[model samples]
Target chain A: MHELGIVFYIIRDVKAAAAENSVQRISAVVMNIGEVSTVVPEYLTDCWRWAADKEPLLKGSELKINMIPAVTQCQDCGQEYETVKYGKTCPHCGSGNTFLLKGNEVEIKEIEVPNN
Target chain B: MDKVRVIEIKKSVFAENEQDANALRQELKDRGVYLLNLMSAPGSGKTTTLIKTINLLKDKLRIAVMEADIDSDVDAVKIKEATGIQSIQLHTGGMCHLDAEMTRQGLDGLDLDGVDLVILENVGNLVCPAEFDTGAARNAMILSVPEGHDKPLKYPLMFSVCDVVVINKMDVAPYFDFDLEKCKEYIAMRNPNAKVIPICAKTGEGVEAFAQWLLEQVQTLKH
Candidate 1:
């Protein structure tokens, strides 16, 4: 649902960046999708295709998403691990007392474009 | 054709939005206002809670509201009619989450000079609104009893980011078999520090408690 809006912003930014760099066409857009984010990669790609095709520079550009798993740092044991299990307590320390460190991000990390 | 990089920007996607929200926080802080971003699913009694809170605390604290919705300002109009406090409606158009820039624009239309507390009723959703920080002093998420106990587990970020969790529609608990203890446990597991308060917005059962807590938060912000 919201992925469409986010994809629009990403395409706009990437296109602006490409134009600034004087790139004729963008090959691909790489994004880091946090596991915690509600965005589904499939939905994002679907929306990207629909939205990107409207722009000439992004007509054939591909949307590449790299999933980042949610990790947490345990306060008791000072350990970090990936946890897909909901209500994830630290496995090693068995502490429900852990803070999320990373993996909650949606960022365009890189854009591949042919140099004119 | 020569390729020239005008700006080699390595900026974040939400950097601009974050900046504006940060500015809003500072502005609210300077105004001695306790900004609270209230988030909840639709029909969670967010508006009812506000109506009760306004009745209890409006006389003591100067209050203002910025209401966010996808379509109508009906809620804002209702709040204004109920409380008669200055209110502004932020039409998100189609955005699920009310970001910093929208909030900043919302504040621009608000008069924060005489306000001691600012309440933002975020767009109704359990997922998207959790990501954007609206530069509020406190973020609250409301969960009504009818929405089921598994909401916190399904939408962990919303509960995790909230400083306070309001369990609204407590009067209907018996009918729905909503586990109060389990709900608290789920929220605690995700956010140990979040204060969980249960209230029946229709009966105004725990509105006093909420208003008191908000007053204390505002007082704390002053010093």
Candidate 2:
């Protein structure tokens, strides 16, 4: 739902970064998407297809999403493990005493572009 | 002809939004207005809370509102009619969440010289609003009892980012099997520091407590 808005921001940032570095055309935008984030990767790509076409540098650029599994660290037992899905309690100590360690990221880690 | 390992620059994806939100936060603080960005699902009684809050604290504080919606000014109109307060309704067209730029525009339209508290009623969506920081001093989220107790688990980011949590629609607790304890536990588990207050906006139960807490938060920001 809000993936489109986020996609716009991603494109905006990547373009700005690319322009700053004198990159002419973006080939791909790499993202680290947390499993727990509400953004759907497919929907994001769909939005990318539409929004990127308007910009010359990103006309054919592809959005590459790297899915990160949701992992949590138990505060009580000091154990760390991947959650079953998005909100499964820690399996090691059965403690709701867990904090999210990763898998909430929605960041563009890198960008690939043509250097001219 | 393929030679060098070009440029390697690592930058944040949300740099622009982050920058804009930071500016907005500073602006609000400079104007001596405590801003609270409110978020919740649709039909969560956010408007009712605002109405009740205005009634309770209008005499003691100079309060204004910026209401964000997708298509309607109905909520803003309601707030104005009920409280006689100055409120500007921002229609984001089709956007689900309000961004820093939008919030800045709204703030520009406001008279903040004497405003003590400014409340931004975010679009009725839990997930997106949490991601966009509108430079507010605090992020407050509402969860209605009818929406169920599993909300904190399903929407962890919203709960985790909240400085205050309002469990609205408590009057319906007798009819619905809403687990109040579970809701509190879930919110506490997600965010230990968030202040959770239960309210029934329809019956005006706990509205006074909510207003008092909000007033204290604003007072703290003044110092």
Query: Which is the leading candidate under DockQ?
Result: 2
Off by over 4 Å in 1: A12-16, A19-25, A54-60, A69-82, A85-87, A90-102, B1-12
The ten-residue window of minimal lDDT in model 2 chain A covers: A83-92
Instruction: Indicate the docking level reached by candidate 1.
Output: acceptable
lDDT of 2 by residue, B1-223 (tens): 4432234444545667889899888877877899999999999999999999899999999999999999888999999999999899999988899989999899889888799999999999988898888889899988998899889988888999999999999888877899999988989878999998999888899989889998998898889
- Please compute DockQ, using alpha carbons, for every candidate against the native two-chain complex: 0.30, 0.44
Relative to the unseen true structure, what is the C-alpha lDDT of residue B200 in candidate 2, on a scale of 0 to 100?
Answer: 86
Weakest lDDT window of 10 consecutive positions for candidate 2 chain B? B1-10
What value does DockQ give for candidate 2? 0.44
Model 1, B30-147: lDDT tens per residue?
Answer: 8787889999999898998999999899889999999999988899999999999999999988878888777878888998787898899999998878877889989998899999
Quality of model 2 by C-alpha lDDT: 0.86
| Each model's fraction of native contacts | 0.19, 0.33
- Among the numbered candidates, top lDDT falls to 2
TM per candidate comes to: 0.87, 0.91
